[model samples]
Target: MQNFKAMVLLQIIISIFLFLSQASSQGIGDKSNVPEYAWLAGNWSGNGFGGTSEESWSLPSPDGTMMGMYRHLDSMGNITFYEFLLLDETGIRLKHFRPDLIGWETKEDFVTFEMVRYNGKIIELKGLIFKRKSENEMEILLKLRKGDVVKTEVFTMKKINKLK
Candidate 1:
């Protein structure tokens, strides 16, 4: 009777161990590939000189890919432009499409992006970089060049009680 009781206890312990082992083996999902900008994985509203713009970002898929779409409108509430961004193993790419430019403009915009090598408070992606200053605040820098002139603008986005 004692041997049978010991056998049952051993089996129970083994089953528990197997369950825990399997649970741990199930990866926590790779956050390494997730950039600082990942915090933007929701709806955002902001305004620039041009006008107000809204954006929406979604979580990365199982394969580690993320994308966001943004809409731009003038003070008159007319759709001025639309843009989208994609981040993947190859890096990050932003495509801007408006009334004047199509796919051809993507190449030119890509070339103007100035990429920084260091991962300081921010991570660099082409011409834009996102710096995580705190849990709720982030700074984004965008670089643009026209002719021989280079210009950069920094935009700070704060969480405003909305998630999409």
Candidate 2:
């Protein structure tokens, strides 16, 4: 009877351990486990290859959607180009707009990227990634491929203003 009781207790312990391991593994792949990207909501400025660049991001909503705008300027402070970004249920989408407000993409089609990986601080899109170095600093890496040539642009931004 003593041996049988000991075996039963051991089985129970093994079962609990297996259950916990499975739960943790599942959480790693669950989207709900991702942290809210609300920290990105604010005004940011930085220098890029073109010149000074500014970006504004909106707070993430309860439904999981956030909007952002980016503008690049030349040394003379003239707006060179602008980009609109959105994060939604489908994924992250980006579109370029001219100074005249003309969109580079058609109404039916636009460039989109999926979140390949996202930790609390680093978010990796398909060809782009944003790493939040600290409360006041962030880095954006964009990879562009044309034919067989690939180029990467890095933008380091500093937080200029916090969202109200």
In model 1, where is the ten-residue run with the lowest total lDDT? 111-120
Q: Which regions of candidate 2 are displaced past 4 Å? A: 1-34
Clashing pairs in 1: none
- Write model 1 residue lDDT over 1-164, tens digit each, in one string: 99999999999999999999876665445456554445656666666545776767677665556687867789998877777777654566667778454653546674233445434266577777767676566676777778999888766666554443
Candidate 2 lDDT (Cα, 0 to 1): 0.83
lDDT of 2 at 62: 48
Model 2 quality (TM-score): 0.74
lDDT of 2 by residue, 1-164 (tens): 99999999999999999999988865635556434565678999998866998999886664557899999999899988899999864568889888888988987777898878765687788888889999989998989898999998899999999975
Compared with the true structure, model 1 gives a TM-score of 0.62
Clash numbers, per candidate: 0, 0
Query: How much is the lDDT of residue 44 in candidate 2?
Result: 96
Question: Model 1, stretches more than 4 Å misplaced?
Answer: 1-37, 99-121, 161-164
